[model samples]
Target: MDLILRCLIFSLLHQSLYSKPYNIDGLLENGTGAIESLAKPLQDISTKDYSWAKGNQTCSQLLKDCKEFLDLLPSSSSWMLKPVLALGFLQVGCLTEQEPFFLDLIKDKNARTLFNIMAEQTNNSIHPTTTNSHKSQPDIQKHDLLRFNLESLSIDAQSISHHMHCSEIQQEQQDVLLKGSILRSHSSLQHAMDHCDRVGPVCAGVTSDTLGQFKSVARNGGYIIPHVGSKLWLHHCTAGLLRRRSTDPECHSEKELRIHNVMQWIPVVSGYYNAGSAIYYATQGCTAQAEDRAIDASIDLGYDALFTATGGVSGAVSAGVGMAVKPPLRDGVKSAINYFKAQWSG
Candidate 1:
C-alpha cells in the first residue's frame, strides 16, 4: 500500500510539472528556491537598463531591488546562496566583458546595422503604444551608444588595474588603439559594415572588427588610455604589497584600489537573475534568453561542483534513509551526460 501511494504521489507531482498554472508554494519553502522564485518577473529586462532603472525606475531596478527583499527574510544555508550568487556574478562578468565589446561594434557601420536590428526588436517588446513606439526608438539607439561609452570607460578601468602587465596592456591597447590616418580610412568602412550585415555570426564578426578600428581612432585622437599605461606604471612603482609613499610618481595607487573595490560589486549587481530559480521550479514566469542562460549555466556548473565538493550531498543524505543511491562514479557519469545535454539544449 505504501509503495503504491508513493508511486501515485510521484506521478501526480511529475505530471504537475508540465501542467498549467504551475505553483511556487512548494519551492518557496526553501531559500534558494524562494530567491529563484522572486527573480521571475524581470528576467527579460536588460542589465544596462536594470542598472539605469535604479535611477529611472525601470524593470531592471525592480529586479535588483530583490536583494533587499531577500535580506529581510531569515538566513539560510550557504548552499542556497551559492547558485544565487553564482548566477549574479556570471551576469555581471558577461556584462562587464561584453559592454565594451558592444561599443566597439557600434562604431562599425556593419555592426551598427546588427545593433539596430537587435536594439529595435528589444525596445518594441518593452513599450507597446503609439507615442511609446516613437519615444522608445531612441531607447534602442541609446542601447547601442552604451557600448561606446562602456568601451571608453573600460580603457580607463584597465588603466587603474595595477596587476596587469605592460605586455597585457599593450595587447589590450592594440585591440582598441586607433592611430592617425587609419581612423579616417576605416571610419567609412565601419559605418558601411554596421549597416550591411544581418546574420548573427557575420554581424558579430563585423562588430568585433569595427571596434578594433575605433581603438585606433580613440588612440590617435589623443584619448587618455587609462589603465593600460597606469597599471604598467603602478607595477613599476610598487613591486610588492609594500606600502610605498602616497606620493609615488608613476602610479595612482589609491585610485586603482578604489576602482578595484567598485568592480567587486559587479556580481552583486548581477545576482538579480537568481529570481529565475523560482520561475523555473514554480513555472510562474516565462523563460527568456538571458534568464534561461543564467539559470542553465549556473545549474550545469553548480550541480557538478556541489556534487563533487559535498561528495554527493543528496546521496549522502539519502544513504541514512535507505533510498536507492547511485555511487559517486556512476553519479558523475550521469551528471556528465546531463551537463552536455543541458549545455547543448540551452
Candidate 2:
C-alpha cells in the first residue's frame, strides 16, 4: 500500500512537469515576482518609439533603485525581491566588464522561461504578424542593445576568450583556463544568489560589499588575459607580458592610451552613426557598431600619437604595417566573432 502510494505520487509529479503550460503565475507569482523591475522596458520594445520605461534604465541606476526598493519592502514580501538581488551581481559584473546587464534577466528559472516566451513571440515564420502588430513585439530594445554588448565584447575580444568558452579545445592547460573562466562566471552568479537568499529582499547595509564584489568580478573573471589586452591576451602571452617598456611602447602605455582613446571616440563615433541613421530613417541600432568602430579608431589614433612620440620607429613602421595587416587579421578573427555573434544575436 505504501509503495503503491509513493509510485502514484511520483507518476503525477513527473507528468506535471511536461503537462503544465507556461503560466503567468509561474513567473510573475501573482505580481509578487520582481523580475518586472529588471524586464520592464518601454511598451513595444520591438519598435523604436518607447521612451524611458523601467527596462531602459541604466544598470548602475537600476541597481541603486532596486536596492532601495528592497530596503523599504516588508519582510514577508521579501521573496519578490529575489529576482533583482540575484541578478544584481551579474548585472554589475557584466556592466563593468562592459557586457550586457539584460542577459541577467533570464537567469532565474521563471525569468528564463519568460525570456523564451518573449523570444518566441518575435518569431516570424511561426507567429508572423504585420508591422504594427503589438502581439508579436518583445518589450525591451535596451535588452536588444545590451544583449548585443555581450561578454566577449568584440571580434577581437571573442578571439582571445574563445579558448575559455570553446568546448572543442583538447589541450589540458587551456581546458583548465576554460574551466576557471566558466567557474568564475557561474560562481559569481551563484554566490550573489545565495547571499541574497540569506540577506533577504533588503540588503540594507551592503552597498560597499556589493560594489566591491562587482568590481572584482569585472576586473578579470580569472581568464588569464596577458597584460590585460583583450586582443593580444591569447595570441601573445609570454613576450607581451615580459617585454620591457623600452622595447615595446605599445604594451607600456596601452592601458592609458586605450581609455583615452575610447573617451575621445565615443561622442564622435556615436554622432556619426546617429547622423547617418537619422538621414536614412533607420531604426535598427548603430550604437554597437559605432562602439566597435570607436575602439578601432581609438587604437589607430593612439598609435599615431605613440609613433610620433617614438620618432616614427614604433609609429610609422608599426602603424603602417598595422594598417596593411589589420584588414586581413580582422578577417581571420571573424571565425570566433561569427560564433558568438550568432550565439548571442540568434
Please give, for residues 1-346, the per-residue lDDT of candidate 2 as tens digits: 6456545643442222111111233333334444553355412212211111123335465455544544543322222123223332332231221234444433444434323332222221121112432311111211121212222222233233223321111111111111012212223434533443343312111111222331112112222211111110111111112112212432222332222222222211221222221111111122243223322332222221111111111111111221111111222223334443463355
Candidate 2 backbone collisions, by pair = 40-55, 307-315
TM-score of each: 0.17, 0.17
* Runs off by more than 4 Å, candidate 2: 1-49, 54-59, 70-104, 122-346
lDDT of 1 by residue, 162-215 (tens): 432222111121122121122222244345233322211111112123323321
Clashes of each: 31, 2
Question: For each candidate, what is the lDDT?
Answer: 0.26, 0.25
Question: RMSDs, each prediction?
Answer: 23.5, 26.3
